[model samples]
Target chain A: MLRPPYEIVLKPYGKALVELARERTDIICLSGDLTRQTETDLFRDALPDRFINVGMAEANMIGIAGGLARAGHTVFVNTFGVFCTRRCYDQVAMAIAYPNLDVKIVGFMPGLSSPGGPSHQAIDDVALMRALPNMTVVDLADAVEISQAVRAVVERRGPVYLRLKRGEIPVVSEASRRFSLHEAQVAKKGREACIVASGMMVPAALVAADVLDANGVSTCVINSPVIKPLDAATIVAAARGARAVVTAENHSVIGGLGSAVAEALAEAGVGVPLRRIGVADVFAESGSREYLFDRYNLGVQNIVDAAWITIAPTKPVPAAPAMPLTAGTYAPV
Target chain B: MQKRARLNGKSPGGCGDGRLRAGAPAPVRVGDLARLATRIRLHAVHMVGIQGFGYLGQALSAAEIFAALYGGGLMRPGWDRFCLSPAHYAVVHYAAAAEVGLLHPEALKSYGRDGTELEAISTERTPLLDLTCGSLAQVISGAIGFALASRYAKDDRRVFALLSDGEMEEGQTWEAAMFAAHHALDRLAVVIDANNSQVDGQVNSVTTLEPLADKWRAFGWRALEVDGHDADALVASMQSTASERKPLVVIGRTQILGGLKSVPATADGHFLKLDPALKAAVIAELEARLA
Candidate 1:
């Protein structure tokens, strides 16, 4: 269900983890000194014994997480998206990924959500993680998925990299909706164009689908939270009927959701015209999310333009309106 | 760069707790450790000879250290965890492990062959080690993790990591050093094969770490420097952790070739290249030492 004026859910990830830790004695948490920003502060304060502050050394933290997992504990390592992935990629690869340890790498402030510019953006994290063998990569959509994914990812056997957005997360799905790692949620159904979106771009995708439907272009939107082992069946089935496909993500189009979708479609032999909506292989500047999104062509209008242009290549598509970023609301049109 | 007298100034007998576990036997005698070291040298020479070439210099230099730990009972079988931080030291580790019956002696012949568990450089798939050192200076942190886990589980089993002198140049080594000391991982011990040799050249010629023991002590650890080939001193310095609450690092100083006379000066010991004649001569010398 596509909900308007999405309500804010605070610390959903932290609360869910603390609740889960109450029952799972083998659950351990590690932070590279971004406990509050990455939403592991609640775990630190509640389960002090199980929480470890590795003090900004991402490499050492990852190595310690591997060791802890070797000793029969599920470790949740938290830090900013960039610091956790790019800064210590070798350690993560050799220590955690190679051994296929049970470590959940929680990276916060996915993509341009951070006002900290290129240095803080994890634009290539998905690509790096996806290339490693036995790594499960995911980008959660909203508060519901973030909370549900905490338990879902722990049940998994090997290493997992879960990308998240920090601070007041939006409630995009119904409160009763169940989250599953194996299924990609179909938010809206139509036949003219298919929109595949992940992470922060899911809301923009939803608004674009509604506007496209109002303009008499039937659009179907699928929210794909798990990026690596993608739900290809539902996406290929939807693309099979649609005349065009537009993939959206809050990451670089080179190796993120767009690339994943492109591979899936190509493998399935669904030759529908495709347009990828993402950061066009460039480092973004520090700014508010609204400014960065529009500048990087991640706004609702970009998806609409991509969706419109691909469906009717012979006709010049009219420029769509900018997304209305209202106060106290998430992705309002 | 130049050799200095032992820094701690504690005699081998004065150092070490020397507490034997109840119903636990004493360590292997010094003469037996010597024989075990001789067997290790013979096996390493044979294995490297079969592979055409390998890190035979490293195996020769650290043969006694490996013998003391694996065969002399310094490292308890199935109790303590051992981390091989220098991946190239797999030559010595495999020979030592095989000498102790952990691995079949015949497996040494497959060294450096395709699809064999004994890779020239150790990896995660390498058997008998708690954690393998794929890249230099990274495995110590994993050893610290194992030590931390032992503490959390209230298990007294200690953790040991073997490093090389070249690893001192890596910043991650210092990062791990600070972390282990800050946490006061007393149950963790590291034995560095300060053999003064690396691929680029000698360690000091590349990057001087002359005040090595001081650097470790400054980082909140008890540092000990001793003759690496003396198994008695190595075991004594290693077992001095019963009362200490800080981590211990034994800097076992060694030679590049452990004074092997057959190889000419032109032969670089870093990655030793042995022709058939030189290989046969080395094997005969090591075999005579074993006999």
Candidate 2:
């Protein structure tokens, strides 16, 4: 099997972002002292006036971006996924997402991109962002995809959370393929089963599909780059045609790509046996990135096993729908 | 039951008979500003009364400051351009915005009603509000970001943020203050409604932010102190912008329970009961003084 190319890395995306910023003066970038890690240093060096370093102030960084968005500047804030998601949830919700501000939140080193441990891992970022009403969540599979996603978000106006891995992963999409914020891409076509994946897991799912094919299990791999809005039609079609579905992600299985696919299938009234392979609801201990992936059962083998189990489905059970809340009973405020 | 006369379109310092025109100019005056402040308080009381209870202590205490800012024309309203940080004193903002004709006066009546947008905390979802600020220290930094954008764009417009004294205790507030000072956001003006009260008690007793002016100055801000209730002092402090460096922080001292005899001036200002009689008495006293 031929290995995917890794020549294009994360830095080029930051460079492309800076190049785009030069053309669009409304673009502003902010970093929480992680420019080097996020590769936004390229943009910072190119456009010094447009880049701001809040220096370990993640909360302030989010707030500042919100304010900048209000003043008609399309602000892009970059930081580690953990800090951007968990540390500054309030700022993101109240200042940016609630207003539906045109602030792009770029979360670098997402989902075990860093080997530092669970502290740096962004397992629940999707869940956190999905809870907000007006937030668009995206997970970039490779460096090439990051540039396209960033450009798409800049051109489109709204609050977006882009999860980016630090280093270069295998490029799943070709240069000719254009990406939209809410559309899903089918990486490979097969009839037996479909594997819906996002972010770093897309490459793994592709590899797993190849493995399953050699074992006489024809598999389809769908790269769901846009996690929010769930690309319902593509997902429903994939689920309907395939005998079963395997959803994979580097994020937590609770509210990441797997959960999003599951919700979409349920909402579309398409009943198919689905299996999720991702981080369980627990903080990971200190380990190397490879070791953590193996320990969490998120590797290609895990995807193959989950896919096999889902395809051998038996019977369906129907449950009663939950009653709607009465006026006095519902209190979100 | 004696019906109170409406004072719409009437000049400042007018009689209740609606006949005697005080002959004041259509232009906003300092005394007229004070009257506007009194009217804001009246509306605030009425809104809270409809809700049965609310954060009226904080709202009433900050009315004069809101009046001074709006009446002075320092803040640009009626145009959907400026942003307001309505953290704890959102009722005062709603009342003042309605009085200034920025929002419909009928909207004021919808305070705390079911499905109404006028929430207890200011929300960014509302078109009139630029950012939601219920979580205390969040809005300060949001304002600083706005100020930075203004500076970047060279727009020359100022971003005004009204922060609570208790909100200063939030670490994010200090973070924003330090950033503002470091950035030298001259276009940003922060007004600390230093009512000396919080949900618990007095700010000093609850969490001491002693030498508050020194703290802000140390954080690289040009800090000033003023009587929060005194419109002239608040207006003067707000008008005087430092040309040298640092963002401006006008720490306006206010009474916890201003103009309310029933509610004692204490730190537990979150929940205060003012029955119909007490409300009537306060409004009558205010009416007589203004009359």
Residue-level lDDT of model 1, residues A11-42, one tens digit each, is 89999899999999878899888889877889
Give the TM-score of each candidate.
0.94, 0.88
lDDT of 2 by residue, B1-291 (tens): 111232111221111122223332232334577778788888887888875678788777888888877676676432112345545577887887777766688788888677887766666434355454777788888778767765775555566778788877878888888888888888788887887777777789888897999999899889999888888788888779656877888888888677566555542566556678767776786677579
- The per-residue C-alpha lDDT of model 1 at residue A41 equals 85
> Per-residue lDDT of B1-291 in model 1, one digit per residue for the tens?
111111110221110121122322333333588778878988888899885788999998999899878865677654567888889999998898787777788888888899987898988767767776657888888888888777877767678889999988987888889999999999899999999898988899898898999999999999999999988788889887556689999999998787677777557777988779998988888778766
DockQ scores for all predicted structures: 0.27, 0.28
TM-score of 1: 0.94
State each model's CA lDDT, in order. 0.83, 0.74
> Considering only N, C-alpha and C atoms within 3 Å, which residue pairs clash in candidate 1?
none
Q: Considering every candidate listed, which one attains the maximal lDDT?
A: 1
Model 2, runs deviating above 4 Å: A1-10, A310-333, B1-32, B78-83, B98-107, B115-120, B125-129, B262-268
